[model samples]
Target: VESATRTAIEAIRTGIGTKPETEIADATEAEAPVREVISLLGIIDGAESDILVPDADDKCPGGYFHCNTTAQCVPQRANCDGSVDCDDASDEVNCVNEVDAKYWDHLYRKQPFGRHDNLRIGECLWPNENFSCPCRGDEILCRFQQLTDIPERLPQHDLATLDLTGNNFETIHETFFSELPDVDSLVLKFCSIREIASHAFDRLADNPLRTLYMDDNKLPHLPEHFFPEGNQLSILILARNHLHHLKRSDFLNLQKLQELDLRGNRIGNFEAEVFARLPNLEVLYLNENHLKRLDPDRFPRTLLNLHTLSLAYNQIEDIAANTFPFPRLRYLFLAGNRLSHIRDETFCNLSNLQGLHLNENRIEGFDLEAFACLKNLSSLLLTGNRFQTLDSRVLKNLTSLDYIYFSWFHLCSAAMNVRVCDPHGDGISSKLHLLDNQILRGS
Candidate 1:
């Protein structure tokens, strides 16, 4: 810059002896090129320039160049027709957006560049050339943002859905979303969240916040009274976390909760009366855990609305009778456990049960009248067990059963001497009994 200024000064001095007006115009035009060179150099080097316009000309001083020459302070929106805004038209510079364009190219592999730009999914929409949508807070998506901290300046008023998935947030500190009071559907899944403070969701009290998804995080436990009074969150997904146990007060204020998913965790125990407050819960997923027993106190009479309960892939060896108090249950999954027997009254209350899964267990005894109350039962899976008998009377009253799986139904009925059914006659029953012709296919 010093060398260029000296060279321009030398040229001005050479024209000092010319006529006054002509000499001044030539020097003025020569100085214009020098200043333009410096401005262009700042753009090329990616540095903040000290260039200034008259305060009167810059209506929005130190603010974004929002449409045309009007300098209004708003959220940054750099996409443009890319021609001119200022007298020198500096706003038109750097229109390529190469840095962000290349970032998407690297993350979305096996796909062409710019494949994910401005895509819309359901109510969520990725930002396009127009920074924010016309429907501002109705659906705001900041997914894959790589943000490490929560921004205190988030939009608060009348916000309904906020999708912050695939970020870098490790913990949810207190008052993190206090500014966003009206946000209803808060989705923070696929983040690195290890801890969540007691009042992390207090801002959602003013609205009918219905869904809270914190799946695929590292959360080990939730604080007592996680939500305040009158909070109406219905869906809570905590799958694939590090949770070991659930305490009673962990869900104290959630009375209207309908669906609770705790699958793929290390959960070993549920405290007595842990779900006493969840009177309206419907679908409960306790699958893929380490629970050996389910306490009856957890399913108080308050759970009259409970319908589906999944306890598959656990280590439960015995179930205390009357453990499942949800009389309206339609689906009961006890498959992939260590159960060796089904008590005579184990399923007496499940009159509405449609699908009963006891497959892949150690159960050998089958009481025919045990499932007499389940007149709506349609599917019963008992594959991969140690049942050595083929008594047709045991399954006689299953009027609603269509697809029933056993060790090998047709083979066991035709010949208990079949190697796969009894392996040897040592376990008893080389006798064969047949009551039907069709074999259950692909059981």
Candidate 2:
């Protein structure tokens, strides 16, 4: 049998060219016993004949060995058996073996594993290879290094959070966000993004983007359709921009928007219709603007959901009657303006207003009816105004008022009347100084 197998292997080696290393090791170790067994089974027809086998030369073909044990004396290579022996270049080539899938998977994972530690990010520079670095659990931090434009392909296919802060981006291109596959939270603060191309955020319209922060940039105007259609965005921060006038349609598409910050701008006029679209808006900050007057009709009736309105350090002089259309406003600030007087019906529509600030104005006197509608008013600030006298009847309706600033007002007539009408008349009399209408202090 061994002789027949060796002969078959020699034929296969002649057919193929090279022998495999694994087959050579198997053939040398399992040869002597196979030859003895083949001789006893009468398989070696030329066993007595001295067949001289030549040494394996450089030109000898290499393959597998086959034997005659009713196992068919076909060459191991021809039968696809993974073994080879014979020195004359037999039993070596074309061996088939099954490879494990898990081995290949592990090799793939290790090759691309440590490459992410060398990633350097900034602004406009895109990574050369498509990869992701996991922060904490599944969050991704994809910052470019001085990236002026957006990358063509995103690193990961499923990202829950993305942070692109602190870059050299001057404008947000329409294709800048094309690589983000499934983002939930996107933060773009301090990216030096000055301009936003029209429909720059159109790619994320149908995506599951929930929170967006773009504060501390040079955005001058927000286009009408900047947000994607049917967006689910809830919080948007656009503070510290160059915005002057906000159109009514600026926030019309953000139906689920809740909080917005537009402070520190040159906003002079706000159309009441501008806020009518933000039905869910609760807090609005408009401090440090150039507002001079507040028109009652310009405020949307839907703003009744608003709780806080900040108009500090403006050039305001007039607030039309029922100007505050919000019914649930709890805090209203009108400080640092040029207001001289507040009309009686100024706060008539604010039924739930609790805190009112009119400090640092030019108010000379307040009528009783001016505070009649503020039944729930608690903290009132009249400081830094030109109040020469306090009308006793003006404060009678403000029974809920706890804090008062009557220090700056000249108390001449109010004190004199209290002394003249004193019923206990022990001795205190109303002393009048001859100079101007000044009341003399009692010695």
Candidate 3:
């Protein structure tokens, strides 16, 4: 009886021999029935058992056994493996596992090149092990991949640059940059990368990483530790990233961050401590945001080394008293905003501010003390706003003010006072239109 059962088992096993072309199809066909039996025994190893079991059963008759070994069978869930498998159920798909393993191994192998190689270049549309190239001494360009995840390995090209622009990459993993150890410049423009996971650039410690282009990514917010640990980062471009607010902790570690491009975002407000952390920060681009107010104390007290600040195209209604904390801020742009009023102490601490742009705003009134602290202000712009009349006090304290734009706005009062008494001044800019509880001319 045992011999007959063994022979039957061997025959069945031989009939179901492995075939690369037919393995997937046969597995699909056999999975349904075996899966049902596996479920009955509450086993998750049906795929493994089917692959690992030999073709012989020596102690059974009629090619069948009613033994009670069902209690020992263990079922494996998907993505639940604690080891390198991570997903035991995925092991059933032979082709998928092979592709994943090859790709992972290729990435792991190239990780040391980032440190040992003199130069590195990357250009990839699809992430696969078969597409890897040896390190060349030229530039690499990889744009428009529509990638939703970071690639396993950046290409290994010595003395080469990387261009990964116009993709759908949402998050960046730390290990993704293990292969580009010697990369000098990294361009990531127009990539729809929304979230940057923690330590995404930790592997770039060995590289100089001079310039990082991250424009038009539609990033709403950033994690605190987005940048790498070291301070080798010089130029960082974060333009068109829909960023609304920035906390102090967001830039705590970026001491070497020099040029920051934050153009075309939604920054309404900012904390004072946020700017104090960037001791080496020089140029800042903050144009095209939704800012409603400007509080000088909201900026850091340590931003005395700042050179340029662009605050154009915002909804800034009021410039609060004792604002403008940066004493050395050279270039300032406040264009294209809904700025209705400029209080007496608006530009208080900006002693060395050189270029001032106040164009494209709704300025109904401006107090003389608004520019009291701006001793070195060279140029001023007041164009494209709702300014009807020119208050003499607006430019009273601007002894060094050069350029002023009074093109837009409905001018009502020719002779208007630009100075107020209280630190918390009354809403004087909005009240300029109310004559008898009615709008004056173009109210």
Candidate 4:
């Protein structure tokens, strides 16, 4: 490979020497990046030959082996089959015995039986060539490899991202990601992961890893210190899992997390002060869970930076007073729940909220001052509820409302000052005015 690179560089020098002085100077002034090809040299007669000329700059694509001595690109499966594929016979030189090959097959699929050198693709060189994982730029993408364990042989230097989605790691042992310390983003989505050992993520302490995605797994609960102390994780997604409950220590050290998605889990409740340590949390998704109530104890007062909180499609039957302690909350989703009433103090502290979603509930009535504190609420969704009548005075204080939705067209009459009201006239109503259904009016 080195000789091939030198020959290419010398050819460029010779070409430049034959060019005009002005042309050579113009070429030197240009700063275009050049990719030198170092494999598969053509013969002098302009005919393809079987002779393999090694080039240092060229690399094989994934699923192919690079024969260094001959610069030949052969299929990876052709190695160690007792065949002389390469001109230098590098493929069959490191063949292992049949007995050892069977032993290493389940542990390291491509080692001992074949070559164990680093796999090269483009400019990225990964430490292991077993799984055929390709590296693009600084990302090592090993998605859908059905890997049972974490890839232990990673490049020594820090990587930017590693995606190992759709594997089968039933349990994540301790120090799962310690091999690549400085990886900023790690995606392990759809890995069928069942349990994560305690201190599994302890190596992320003071590291630059910002995003972690372990959604679509079978995690029953979060291990203690799931995120190490002083870690820099920003976005964490554990959605579509089997998390049954939460504890305060499960999130002890994640002070920098901004978004925490626990949606589509089986979480029924959380311990007190469970989220008190996450002071910077802005977006929390607990939708499609089994939460039955919301009280001050479960949601502490330390969530000062929370902006969007989703509790949609849960089993929430009650929302105690002062449930939302976030001062700057903008959007709150409570749709598809079992709440039957909107009390006066249910949303008293959400003075800065702009959107409120209470659709698809069992709401029957609201207190006179239910929305008096929502002065900045611009969007309200009350559709798919069981409410029969809505008083205009209940929504009078919402002067900034731009849109409101309801199941019946008649409810739009009570939405005063709202610029847009949905269900402009169902089959039984008209745009001019609401049609009070006889069944709902007890006719």
Model 1 C-alpha lDDT per residue in residues 1-443, reported as the tens digit of each score: 64444444445546543345565565446555444533532322222222333356554332233334444322122222333434545445544433223223322223111233354443333334243322232566667778776544445455566667788888788867655546667778889898888877776666678988888899899875478877879988888899998988888778889988888899998765788778889988888899997655546677788887888888999887677877898788888999988766677678887778887999888665656677777666677888767565555556565445566433234221111222211221211111011121111
Residue-level lDDT of model 3, residues 1-443, one tens digit each, is 53343344334545764445465455335444544533543333224222222235423221121222321212222111222221233322322222113222321223212432464443333334343232334444555766555454554545345667776676766666656646677778887778777777777666777778887787888876776667488777777787998877776567888877777788888877776768888777777777777775666677667777777777777777766666677777776777877777677677887666676676777776667877666555565656566656556566554333345322211211111101111121221112112222223
**Sorted on lDDT, highest at the top, how do the candidates line up?**
4, 1, 2, 3
Candidate 4, 1-443: lDDT as tens digits: 53343344335556543555575445433412111110211112222122343357776653345665877865433455445677788766645333222222322222110121343453464444443467755667777888876677554456776778888888889856656547878888899998899888878886788988888899988886577677899988888999998887888878889989888999998975788888899988888899999886778888889988889899999888788888999888888999999888689788998888898999999988888788888778898999979988888889887667789866766863454566643443221111123332232
Which predicted model would earn the best TM-score? Answer: 4
Clashing pairs in 1: none
Q: Candidates' TM-scores? A: 0.61, 0.58, 0.57, 0.67
Stretches of candidate 3 off by over 4 Å are 1-138, 145-160, 391-396, 408-443
Lowest lDDT 10-residue stretch of candidate 4: 34-43
User: Please, what's the RMSD in Å of model 3?
Assistant: 33.2
* Per-model lDDT: 0.62, 0.59, 0.56, 0.71
List residue ranges in candidate 4 displaced over 4 A: 1-132, 152-158, 427-443
TM-score winner between candidates 1 and 4:
4
lDDT of 2 by residue, 1-443 (tens): 64454445544545664356576456535554544533542233433211232234422112212322222223211232233333332333422211112212212223211324455332223324444432422345546556565444554545555666666878777787776667767767678777877787887777888778776688878875688778888777776678888887787677787777677777888788788888888777777778899876767898657887778778998888878878888778777889998777788877776777787899887766777777776556666888767766665565554334334323322322211111111122211111112222112
Better of 2 and 3 by lDDT: 2
Q: Which stretches of candidate 1 lie over 4 Å from their true place?
A: 1-138, 151-160, 411-443
